[model samples]
Target chain A: MSNQKLFHVAVVGATGAVGEQIIRLLETRDFPIEKLTLLSSERSAGTKLTFKGNDITVKAATPDSFKGVDIALFSAGGGVSLELIPHAISHGAVCIDNTSAYRMDPDTPLVVPEVNIDRINEHKGVIANPNCSTIQMVAALKPLYDRYGISRIIVSTYQAVSGAGSRAIDEMLRQSKEILAGNTVEPQILPVGALPVKHQIAFNAIPQIDKFTENGFTYEEMKMINETKKILGDDSLEVTATCVRIPVVYGHSESVYVEMKQDFDLEEVKQLLADAPGIVLQDNPAEQQYPLAADAAGKLETFVGRVRRDLSNPRGLNMWIVSDNLLKGAAWNAVQIAEYIAIEQK
Target chain B: MSNQKLFHVAVVGATGAVGEQIIRLLETRDFPIEKLTLLSSERSAGTKLTFKGNDITVKAATPDSFKGVDIALFSAGGGVSLELIPHAISHGAVCIDNTSAYRMDPDTPLVVPEVNIDRINEHKGVIANPNCSTIQMVAALKPLYDRYGISRIIVSTYQAVSGAGSRAIDEMLRQSKEILAGNTVEPQILPVGALPVKHQIAFNAIPQIDKFTENGFTYEEMKMINETKKILGDDSLEVTATCVRIPVVYGHSESVYVEMKQDFDLEEVKQLLADAPGIVLQDNPAEQQYPLAADAAGKLETFVGRVRRDLSNPRGLNMWIVSDNLLKGAAWNAVQIAEYIAIEQK
Candidate 1:
């Protein structure tokens, strides 16, 4: 560890939910860091965060914040990433963005390290992390995709409040308490859209995650559809998604139905998933063992279970995938990319 | 109303979650009942319930409980139905069962009043109500099936805890309070199965609903599959389901993917649903209006929204369906069948 090459790292949106996880991952993984810089919006600029038993005060992020920084991780929002990514690139720093800004940009690579790490080398400056729901799904299915080719996917998500941000989490908790206390709740932060309407997230399921697109799908659903194809490098693959938000605090659970190109054995399919990288198989029907969001919270690995052959279509398979939305879906994925870059540079 | 002939009615499991809803519907809808008899297990036998402002004492359900019953409604567990339904039949009572025991029985007619009311006459003695999750999906899709022949269906459910029973609802509420207080919870009554494994349903999603069948699907999933085919009266229709238990208290939401035998116009599809019986169309993406479980709670109508054509298959459509599992899914559906019987007899 002492002989490794040390690089300077900068974390934008350091006070945000995903950004906090990124800092924690970096500290726990013992990443070779010569120096660390924390950057947030001016509203949160003066906040001090502790890392490795030392205090580092956050500064307001600007185009000039990337100077001398070897790698810059961004999760503030799409607006911040779109405005500052070019400056970060011109300063000779590779950017790992955790927003929708550069994800579908043709030049930028959308990479889930387990699914498409090779594409990380093709990035001009930014490697975009797929949506939190998409990351766990593709990571769990990549092994199956390799074993037997996949032609189509239909997915329905039970997503958590944390994917929307920390405020959404607080809203769910507060609303839940309010409902439990027999009071009417005023929803303020869910189904985050341009409209004034908000739905209660406590004891409810909100079908809309982001604003509706022209095609009648929410931005979150379209992200899962478009980003899955991009990360898998298969534009011809068919994908449809319905993303719904539940009251869970951290993990996102997905019900995935995939139509394979060839007929496969169910036991072999289970074994392939069990052997996959970054995927833990928890499917034991006799024992009633399956993935639950509460169990997957704070974990880095994606959990897959409830594997069964579709009774209607011979080539179709059904399974459940779960993961900590902020961990594998955002922070750990970005950190894995940074680790790959560190190894390549060394 | 004074000229109508009234019949003696009995309600098994009168104190249950679904049974309570049934009694409320009976009172609100002004059903022509000459006498209302409330029956329960030996444990809750003496519970007092008021119907039409008359106090009725609950009696322990037994083989002789239906001796003079002209119409009997059963919402107790399947064990009670399987054991006592035949006795009700021998005593000449036409039973409307909300349990799965007689749903697939060839002699019994599984009736959803809006979908297959005509089949009610074929019942030997019992008319079976479909599973709660299955009831809502089929209700929403029946209009579409009539307009465009449905070839296949794939559904993923976000079900409420009350579907299990009143005890499960209490467990969820208690668990949520414990979690809010930052204490660990010991789950005792969720994922109700033969095995002893229980999952935390507060702020979590459980993939298993009932016990797993030999085919790797839960009994709840199989109930949705087999019951849909039987109710639709089409043995060739293909169906698949993934039933999940969420933290909600009342309504169940479904994400359904259906492929039709004929091509469909999206606007025409919306019009058909809006005009259908017992279905309310809440689908206006421009106004961010879609079906939500929280909003659907206590409502008897099945709410449909988020209708869109599949990106890959021209004949395929995706929709979101929500309904109060106790009302439209169970109690209201059973009552609709009883109403039809009363009208037929009159």
Candidate 2:
């Protein structure tokens, strides 16, 4: 134990969903920490949370909150990350952001540890975590891409309501109850974006996950397309995505079809996926076993199944990918990078 | 109105979800029905349903039930269809079967009215309605396929609970209430297939919709693949599908990507869809206008939106297609065929 060097860590947005998960993971993983500071917005600063049998009072995050902090995790929102990430980096803290603020920034390496751990060394001060939907997809695709060159990708997402936030989870639960009780439901917080018109997601699927871009793709879909390319470090690869938010509370499921540049053996592809870093292969169809959103609620690994070669395109492969949006998608991913940095420091 | 010929119509599975919708559409459309007979299994027999301000008793469907029946709509289980359809045909009743029993039969013409209405003439005895998932997809793709010549198609579905039947609807509603009340839910009816395993549909997505084939695709997915080919009368076209069941009570939403053999003009494709029959284009992304399951529920028209050309494959196009699974997908389509047959006879 004495050979391990402990570091001071600060968790921003410490009261939010992904932030709370990050704190829980830090405690459960027994990360080497000499001191832990929990930080949130002014509205939630005074709240207390127990970690390692100690009550830690969360403080309002500001530029000074990063003083002497070796690692800072940001997950409040994109705006908060843009405001506080620079301050944390200036204070000599390596920031692992869970927001999209710096994911596309060429300087801040977008790391999914299993896919691109070496890229962490190129991060100047910040390492951005990919979107929850993008993280699970690239993790499953990385091994396949390495084995057989991927030329194009098309994905359709069945995303959990929790990806919007805790409020959206509450909204879905509330709406479901209201509809079941024969009462009218007024939707308040789904499709979280700049749009004023809210759609009911209690028992429905909404195609727009985020605000629409100049092209027809929503911001969430664009994030998957761009973040995947950045993490894979190839801008020329073709990617298209349709992001839809379902009533699921925890896990995000994706139906991904990829066209490989070369023909490959199906058995080899299955073996490669079975041996991938943070992936669990659950592709037995006869027993009716596959990765489902319910079974993937709290797990940290990406669960992939239903792998088959496309009937039409011999070079195309299709698979279903599922993972907990808060874990592998956000919290655990950030922690993995932090662990890498700690090991490199030793 | 007097010049129109009246016919005796029999509705099988009259107590089920799609059966109820067929009766409602018949009443609303004021179809020329001289006598209406509601037929169900022995379990649902003696139940009474009102049509055109007249109460009709649902009787046990047998060989004698089709006596003097000019047109019959069958939505019962596949076993019942296989047993009763031959008897209905022998009695001179044109059967429009909504089950999968005879959809792939060489003599049975699979018909989606808007796409292949002329095929009704070639039906030897029964006209098979495509699967609920296949109906909406082919309806949206017909115009595009006609103009650009489709080479391949890949689709992922967000299906409704009601497609599994009325019991599945009750199960989903009950599960949602139990889950919202923080109680344990015992799922009994989702992914209704030969498998005994049931999955929770409340706030979760089940990737398997039907019994898995030897090739790892479910029967529902294979229906989408084979039905598209037969309905289009082109066996060489490539198609693949992933069918997922959500908690939605009505309406099935599809994320479809089609690779056209020829280059397409995006504006021209939009115009083609807009000008097509039984298709509604709601694709203004600037206003967050897109087809949603909630909006498409209980509507007869196939709602299409989010039409965009793929960024990676110039010849590939992506669109979101949605329709009430019981309406345009089943009941309304069957009724449309019946109306065409009546007109052709006159």
Candidate 3:
């Protein structure tokens, strides 16, 4: 490793779920940062943050906030990223965005390092991190796509409330207690927060994740459908997604069924995934071993298990995908891409 | 209408989630039960249960407990059903079982009333209630199955922990409090009870519902696959299931992708579901309408929404199915089958 001097980094929306993850990941991964900046909305600004034993002050993210910053990581919201990310880029700083605003743009190199690290060099000012559901999926699918030529993917996500934001997580907890106490609690954070309608999430499974499209798929569903195709670089591959928010906190688990163009034995598929980057294989059945959200939370790797061939379809395979949504799905993935970009820039 | 008097009813496992729903259903629907029998395991026996201001004693279920029992509904377990159902059947009582011991048996009729209520008459001794996930699926698919014969089905479930039993629900609550308090607590009841392993169901998801079959599907998953065909009276429809446990306590949701044997218009399919038995449609998109677990919990109807066509195949349709697992998925469905059998026997 070349001893290149480190660059200073700032993370906007520093107190949110994904933002807090970016902070923990920076310390654990030993990201080479000479200094760190913590920024949030005005309400959260001025809060003191402890990072690597040093307290850092958080400031409001404004247009003039990125003069000396070399790189800015964003996960606040689509609106915040839309307003502040370009301003950060225009101020001589490269941005890695973890929102949908820039992901579909042809110019932005939407990246998952394990899937396509080389695409980092193609960044056009702003790099996009694909949806959390898409990132884990394509990471798990890429090795198989390269080896078996995946022609189709059908994914149904069991998502966590933390994915909606910090308040959504709080709503789930508050409502759980209220439900057990035999009190009625109103929901305020799910099925599109701005829609003026709230549904209780306690002891419930809601099929709608984001606002609906005229075609009937929710925005979260469409993001996974389109982002997977864009990241895998296979426009012809069929992708269908159903995104649902369950009463989970950290990890998002998906049941993925894929039909490969080339047929392969189940052992071969397991072996290939076992050797893939950023993937952990926990497929031993004798021990009742498999991936679980409790074990996967706070971890960066995508866990794949319960892998098998579809009983009725000759070319189909079924598997379970689990990853900590806050970490790998959002903050960790954004940071991982930044690391790859930093190494190449060096 | 003839003046035939309706028989008395008994709800086994009356103190549990399903039992509560069964009680409410019998009262609300005004099913003509001359007497209501409330039975439970010996540990919970002797408690006084009040229904519509009438008090009843919770009796311990034993092999000889079926004497003079008109209809005994069993939601206790497969072990309890296996032991007591034969005795109930021999004593001129119709047994409606809500466990897996007899679902796939050749002589037993696995009934989802919307699909094949006629199958109830075919029950030789015990009538099996289809798995909760399977129940919602076939209910939504029955209309589509009749109009356009279904060739295949791929389903991924976002299941509630209450599907496991009451102890799992308690574990979820206890663990959530422990997590919110920032403490470490060992998990005791999730995924499966017989397995020594445990997982935190609070803010998490477990992919393996039951023990894995040699074919890679969990026993819960296999239940969905096998029971769907049997309940629909056709073993030829290709079906696959992936069962997952989320933090939700009451309702089970499914993302079902169906390939119709014949062509289907999206609106026609939605209309068919609207007219189908026991299904409630909430598919208006401009107003942001759809099914939610919070809305369906404690309600007996199966909720269907998010009806749309698949992006890649004109013959394929994707829909979301939601229902309170304790009600339609477990307790009420069993009671309804018992009601059907009582009517058919007369």
Candidate 4:
């Protein structure tokens, strides 16, 4: 091997759904990792998971876990990140968080590599990844925004179950089987929020993704609205979102209607999207081709299809965007930030 | 019993999903029915069903099926309606069609009973029921349109599999089980358009509902756009729709964003919607109470919830509308028309 610097990487929440994806991606991608530290909560501390064909035991993520860590990727809950991120920073480790703990914070730059990779340089010690639904939309819409100057966005999402965690995936699958067998089921962990009420997610759609805020918007919707403006570095853009969770296991699909400040030709807009980075255009209606969540389950790139000019408005455009919520939405975005940091260090 | 003038009613496609609902509604409602004639295609001609504890055999629908029929409810395919509606009209039967064959006809009134019952008198032998997705939206928005005057509507639907037909319901159920069991499934009946491509509706969402027109909007989407303007009687109203089929078995849900011509008070708007006939208000965020598809199934009223004013636009509002696709969306709408006809005849 060439003599290149291999940095020590610490992965917190290594056993969770997105954390698992981060570990798998790190093992598969060409990253310079000298030591791989898999850290989790106390419940899953002793679990053994293999990475790069070597068995690694998950350790409890204490403040000292990042003693020699060069870059730490955090996918744990917000409370864990809040308590431990400062400690990791004190130990001279850069934190790339996938949770909503510090996304809207002015100090922590929210990064979507496809949309705003340059924002990584502005991070003091932590760079937050945007929400799963927001990541795909911004990534797909960045090209359009750069070309025609977006004014407003109205998006309705068809989110998957995996965004809730692995437990939610289990809950959806179990509830589906029970419903299919004519057996009743009690929902335990859906519409994950501060409330006690839980709605059924089997063969149904839940409109509220997170808890409702004071202004009658869900926390998840607010995250999309706020983080989109932050990531695009435009505070004046008008954005509205209706975040919905469907029974799909992995990908999140959005029906986005955007209004542009300047006029746009439909053919030129399609060409712009086709030439954009990290976007795959799939909009042939005659062949029944469009971006589907099932087809985008394991893929890293965002899929954009059903692109058409809005019938009523001259400058409005409609599109359907799909991507694996875990990979591109969370893990891969964090890893891409970490890779950028690694390359800068070299 | 009150002596009401009983009319002979014929239900074409009686064995189909919507046709079955119409028969049941006729049995339970106070409609004056002297004779009930069940008609279907040749394949299902001999099937027997019960109405008011009396057995009726399904007859093959033809020109003579409406010989003595005072009002005929047609839910058969569009081809059947296009071919046989003229014969029914020639036989002096006032046809209330549930198919799209006569929906866009200038002479045929596209009716959502709550929104356009007064237009029933203008029908020239055939009154067309609006699309299932359109029926719920217009019924929910009629009050707002009457109060503040709607200028534009942008809607995204989470439609049910039942909108496709009974066979689609079976396919969704079967594929859901196969998917839960980790077996591969071949989709056959979903995205029920002219195209040969089929998508798995078990845990996925299909963006295309009906066949796409030349402009890339699906027929279902176009139906929502065109039918909204027609049913509202405002050709100047701007409307757009993205119809998507999810895994729900019944009850279509829509995330609707509308721009009103006049300003609206949120509390007064809620009061107006709550006081509106044939509309249910279910918007309480604190208790996690909202209109759910599972709860809306088999209900007659359209449920409106999550009503809020848009943060950016002064005249914009966002709401969630849901209803049983088979009830208010189809059979009940037709039956409501037929009941008006009976009242007028009396």
Evaluate all candidate structures by whole-model CA lDDT and list the values in order: 0.94, 0.92, 0.85, 0.92
Chain A alone, model 1, TM-score?
Answer: 0.99
Whose lDDT is higher: candidate 1's or candidate 4's?
A: 1
- Summing lDDT over every window of 10 consecutive residues in candidate 3 chain A, give the lowest-scoring window: A196-205
Off by over 4 Å in 3: A1-3, A79-91, B6-24, B34-63, B67-70
Compute each candidate's TM-score over C-alphas. Answer: 0.99, 0.98, 0.93, 0.99
Per residue, candidate 4 scores C-alpha lDDT tens digits across B7-28 of 9999999999999999999989
Model 3 C-alpha lDDT per residue in residues B1-346, reported as the tens digit of each score = 2675677677788887778778888888777777888899999999898888899999998877788877888888889888888889888787888889899899998888878887777778678888899998898899899889999999998888888888998898888778777898888877688987777787777777888778778899899988888888787889988888887777888889999998878878888899988999998877777887767888889999988888878887888899988888887888778677667756
Decide which is better by DockQ, 2 or 3: 2
- Predicted candidate 2 versus true structure: per-residue lDDT over A1-346, tens digit per residue: 5789999999999999999999999999999999999999999999999899999999999988999999999999999999998899999999999999999997999999999998999988899999999999999999999989999999999999999989999899889888887898888877764578788999999999988888788889999999999999999999999999998999999999999999989889999999999999999887778899989998999999999888778998989999999999999999999999989886
* Pairs that clash in candidate 2: none
Residue by residue across B1-346, what tens digits does model 1's lDDT show?
7788798999999999999999999999999998999999999999999998889999999999998899999999899999999999999999999999899999899989899999999989999999999989888889989989999999999999999998999999999999999999999999893569999999999999999999889999999999999988888999999999999999999999999999999999999999999999999888889999999999999999999998888898999999999999999999999999999987
Judged by lDDT, which candidate is best?
1
Identify the CAPRI category of the predicted complex in candidate 2: high
Give one digit per residue, the lDDT tens place, for model 4 in A1-346: 3787899999999999999999999988968999999999999999999998999999999998999999999999999999999999999999999999999899999998888888788888899989999999999999999999999999999999999999899999999999899998898999883569998999888888989987788989899899999999999999988999999999999999999999999999889889888899998998899999999999999999999999889999999999999999999888988888988887
Docking class of 4: high
- Cα displacement (angstroms), candidate 4, residue A307, comes to 0.4
Candidate 4 lDDT at B92 equals 94
Of the true interface contacts, what fraction does each candidate have? 0.79, 0.77, 0.73, 0.70
DockQ-best of 1 and 3: 1
User: How big is the positional error of residue B160 in model 2, measured in Å on the Cα after superposition?
Assistant: 0.4
Which candidate ranks first by DockQ, i.e. highest?
A: 1
